[model samples]
Target: SSDLSDEDKIDQKGIRNSPYFKPDWSPELLSNGNYITHFCVYKNNVIEELKGFRGDYSGSQDYDLVLRATDKERKIEHISKILYGWRQILGSAALSTSSKPYAYNVAITALEDKIKRNGYDGKVQQITDTFFYRTKYEYGNPTVSIIMPVLEDLEILKKCILSIKKNTTHKSYEIIIVDHLHKKKELESILGNNCTIIKFDEKYQNSKVYNSGARVANGEYLLFLDPNLEIITNNWIESMLEVGFISKVGAVGCLLFNNNGQIYHAGKILGLDGICSNALEGRKHDNMYFGIANAIRNCSAVSGKCIMIKKNVFDSIDGWDENLFQYFNDVDLCLRIYESGYRVAYTPYVKLQKQNQITDDFSNEIDQRKLFIKKWKHVLEKPDPYYNENLSHVNGGYFLTSSPPLPRLMTLLLEVYYERIDLQTQFPEVAEGDYSNLLKWVINEGIINDSYMVTLAPFDKDFEILLQKYSQ
Candidate 1:
């Protein structure tokens, strides 16, 4: 048992929800290493291996030590239990980050050194004035062809093009707009001398329109964008290119927000209601749950509204499924891209604005969804590698489900059994002597259906008491 003062116990509640306690810590986790600085306990032997901390980095000595201690072979394990507490005394650096601003700089240095040691080709930069940092992957500049599909909304198209021209910092790019159906002179005027507008005199299909644009694209990469989108981040193109140019990455997507600043698309998760839905839809752009909304991670699919892929990769996949036409073509294309041995990644650094509308013609959308399910039935049956099993498929977001824990329940049972067997442990016996039955009852009643309940179950007193009681 560790000493936890009254104040420490109060602070531990907040720390438990942070990214530091996230389940795994791999090389990718280390690359984005700013979150692991607080409430950590390093072994005496591991500290000795790092030859103690440098006095020069006194303010961020713990951060430096943790970085040196964990490597690819010897990674850090995050225990959900709070075994220790941090006391924030007056004038202590922990009490106030402003007390020693030098620590921030040293922390950045430590991250840079760690990246070098791990052979990660990236640059670390402080995110605004905050202690949080972002790692930008470095790859040579490649010309990108932006393929935008539009109907006849010239005003919206003009805004989208203007935003891209004004906000985009990447220089090596060309815009190719696929004109579908209505041919407005305003669209031609909006195209100006910069863009190449191609006419498609056929039925409106997003996949075919994009494929038509891709055929004439000369750039090394293809950026499929919706003309209704307003670019929010100046570095959007640069950020997408950084991830898209990677050999292992098939496609990269940015966070998309509606006009009201609510999330429209963060990433696409498959098997949600037997089709694909945007991960973290209708949430704030910065809502950090399991660090999925904020961190760079692989996903099965991303919204084609604003996704980038290598020109060759698109060609290899034979472009999108023309049969999908309008809805779920992005999902179909992304799944094929994944099957073709390439990872699809979503990054929060680049964000865009668009007004998304769920189609009222449910029958047509449902028909397209059926075609999608028919094609990828095998994938829907399996667990999504990018998403956790505990998360719900009932909704688009990563909400927890009422499904029984199965293997996870076995681990929880072992923990409860060991606690009861330990004589010195303060752990109370099941109030009614049958903990297994209580767990079963709780699952049956749907008490642990959501993520909030599951996360707090181990520490929540009422929850623990409920688990201890036997059901009728």
Candidate 2:
């Protein structure tokens, strides 16, 4: 059913009447939970297989059926056109999700069943509302070694340590502070007998320092944290440990907030700006997008600033790439973890405040980015499965791209032509064919102007001509 108002219906066609109503009901998308509300079609056989909708879940019977139908390995089609009419009524379940509380309860059971069927060792818990839910993994209490790489910022480090001591509810955790050079007596006195400070004379390399701390870490889990972080959530360590101890989870990260309460680190997405940074940085930590910001979910990579990994999993990966000293070492390690068939998870429950900002030299960042790109070019080229393809790659925060591609041959041709660095370079995969004459004509005439004014007649005619050639 369309949620559009009367004004929306008059000014712009409602979703039911819009031409752009086609949706891809891929298994991956369905597994993340359904976002669509109406215009569903199902085969008689699939209906029979599901044994029809359960009468117990009267309000969400259709949703229950949909979940059950998707659970099986069967083909599901999304009709581009809305073929059914959804009459609006006073007490329609579509309009009022709260009318029937039993439906929401049953829905939770359905989702939990799906999780169990999928063989994931996690339980579903309702979020703020019963309509939305999140998964919580069950991992026994394991000793966690919190590794903090610190420089000379004693004040910030002291606050960080104090916050951990005061706020953290999780016991059986040890703090291993890797001191670089500025090992002050005050810092030692502050640490006292609580933390084991490892002094290193080598120049500051984030990866090397973490590796050094891990070498002496006796805990089952290794938590790599920055000295600037102040623990905000009481069960922060437990939250991270729960996800980290999952057999299939290689690494788990927490949501970090800046002084202004803006999101500092909330997992990460690879292939963004050649290297990777925090996904959805600068957004309010609680601002939910498709239930992502509010739930525990899998990601391609996560920030190392407050990430935890099982000791064995860390050892298996041989620790962080020291070559990627200052930057992208975390992303690289997470990528390796992904390649090794373990998922990287991010949970918003464990929130932390980062007091100090870690600034990197511009030139050094560029160099690090180049190294990261060179090593993971193939992964960069591929779409991040955890992230939506429609989202812009240029922005770390998931935003819709301006001037999205039109489903026209000329638009594709223009895109391919623009992608080419030089005339000699091969065209994009979409425009890969022998169009020597068209290329020559385009090169000679330059159909696309410097200011990108598309006089479409020439390109359109050339595309048709090429289409005719390819058709033969």
Candidate 3:
């Protein structure tokens, strides 16, 4: 903007511009952000290539400009609010309006060029998905073979593949599609140069298809994906790859979106409300980084829809248990990974939009009460998973404990049931005496409340500080 001459401004003003100019925004007004801005728009031409642009993108010129500006050495004021609106009117040249195949061609060229430009020592040919940017020394990028299980949906699967071929930042990868019962002609026509199709005779089961793909995969890392999802960004592979490289992270997953473009899965909580619920079930993209197409975080488990695992980790864990057909396959994998002493992460950054999503499909009304009781029968049993009587309510660490929901609830219900049964009849000593101590511990820890430990008791100052810090 500083390069514009006074004469040029005057000429534009004379042509059609208004006399009044917008006030220069102050740095203070933009501070103390109540909201996070999606991205800052830089003043630059879309088609013209700027000098010193870190990466080359014939089509994503605007994107490169914005990225460059964001990484500049200035106190780039975070416009603590949505400052501008880019109005793409109907029939305008919106990016998606372009022909899909043409866009794919442009995106592929730009991606390969960028990858080669940013790759380790310019060795683009060998760069794998697992090779995130390393600062210390260049480590050998172990080849990662990704096995995607394809069903009969050729169109959705094609979009997924095109998205990857165009946007993927890592190139040292192959797509092996285990077409477990699909039309031969459609599958053959769509399989690209970089992908292979394996036909299986049996009926389609997700775990079995993935296991079949892993048997002949030649990469150092293995990535599994469901075909009904579209890859959205270049960072998808790299994001999971970085997480997978961490010693603690056994598996990595991305956020899933419903057809409406709202969030479906950020990650699943292991034990919440008697069963695991995918966190952030229905949240809108306020243009913040958290719900963006590719924000990464540590999570309980990656969804089976899309997951990345190191080859060694996969083998050591004995791969997917074909016993788990589909629904809990991902959960079983995560639990196995944890049991094998590895962490499961949920990165919101990487994104895939689920196709044929039943986002609003809760039409059938099932028995809510009966279902709830049956689900928590494990918790009603003997040993509680999270009911530590020793730890005070002030302790904030119970959420991370290994107590699965069912057993914990089962233990509580039995204790209360037995206590009430003995109240009327002179029954045996049925109530577990330890329940009092455990209840007290749960109450004090703030899991449950009791009248016994009211504010009437004097508290230690040291204890107060410790509790406050943890609680906060």
Candidate 4:
């Protein structure tokens, strides 16, 4: 294929192990750089709807058009078979984004237009010195109820309350602390006049406590927050509301890092490790997992730790399923939200420090998994749409397979794990948005073993030359 083409390399932006795009993977996953390569054959009507391309964004005319077209949820397909060659001529933005510097600026304008059209009051903040962006949406100042289930560490509860009071700029919110009936005196000492303590007589049950807090919540939106989380971003609540405001998006969650600063929760995958697992768990947030950890995207499930949703929508799902007890309660809640035709969403604009010192009181983990399996076996049986079917079970579930479904030079990077220096993350900034740095991070820690990194990697004369060009 490379011999047939003017260039000897595949499109770095589309160097994915899987050839298909997630249905409706736009506004969040879609950006100016990756996956917007030229030679796209579009339906005439779709092109006509966007008026083809604008002249104002000359360097990135197609990028602007694609952003505008996909803004309204148009289904896009990624055809794997190569249909044409792309010439990487000198001075072309494709060869080096710096060659046409105005392209990145035009891309920012294009993203801004997309955000404004979506009814969200947000500005697209470009990642400095890079073509990537993160949209910050303003909170409309609607009333929100903050539900804190106090199961452990009254000390952490104090920090959480203080963080909300100190960092959160949104004043139109009420903090409802659900806890043991006997701990009222102690809770009052910490919260004082800042929060309302709802003491219950029953033992600690996350589902029950969440439902109880929802029952008494008076705000239009309900934020199910764990008492162990400390807010870092000032506009955390507002940022989440940006995604929550999207049509058909039922629940919104934010990125939560553990005390050590590693990502513990960004979003949930239904079948990542087993039934479900955290997305990009234990990995740093900078440019990770197809940039999913930091991007505003649709996910299968969002964690209950920092999730926000409309009151009526939460009630529509009848709140959490009380039978599950502890683990997977959030996953089950998200699945039901999906069954009701609403997308569970996640955003990285909000960052929270997770305090994991406290231990949970519940111990019905085995039974809960059974309940989850019995209820959603139909959904779990399928591969997680947000994750690749060709990925490995290790390295946070973001590594390539030993024998990738579709092998390429990127597979050469897969043999080695994180033990070696990671070129993928380090080299992405080499050419910014040109897909060069993007390709380097593909194999990452999984480097080649022996003569082959990917056991099934092609070894023809052309393939060897391709390997020689990228082996380092």
Winner by TM-score: 4
What digit string (tens of lDDT, one per residue) describes model 2 on residues 177-197? 887875756677888655898
> Sorted by TM-score, highest first, which candidate order results?
4, 2, 1, 3
- Per-residue lDDT tens digits for candidate 3, residues 39-92, read 243445422434534444544444334333333233332222223432333433
**What is the number of backbone collisions in each predicted candidate, taken in the order shown?**
0, 0, 25, 11
Which model is ahead, 2 or 3, in terms of lDDT? Answer: 2
Clashing pairs in 2: none
**Which 10-residue window of candidate 2 scores lowest in summed lDDT?**
1-10
What RMSD does each model have against the real structure? Answer: 11.4, 8.9, 17.2, 12.0
Which structure is stronger by TM-score: 2 or 4?
A: 4
Query: How do the predictions measure up, each by TM-score?
Result: 0.66, 0.71, 0.50, 0.75
lDDT of each: 0.66, 0.66, 0.50, 0.67
**CA error at residue 34 for candidate 1, angstroms:** 6.4
Q: lDDT tens digits, residues 1-472, model 1?
A: 1111111222323452221223233233334444444556666766677797888777777778777776434535444334444444455554554766787788888877886886767777866534556767676678889998884556777888899988877878899988886665657777765588888888777888999999999889999998778898888888887667656678988888877888888888664543457887877756455456777667788999899998888999899889988778888888999889887888787889984453434446545755665577567645565555555654455665455332322333333334334421322444324455545434554235633224224323343444544343
Candidate 1 Cα misplacement greater than 4 A, ranges: 1-30, 34-122, 128-132, 137-140, 182-185, 290-292, 355-363, 392-472
70 in model 2: Cα distance from truth in Å?
8.7
How high is the lDDT of residue 349 in model 1?
79
The 10-residue segment of model 4 with minimum total lDDT is 1-10
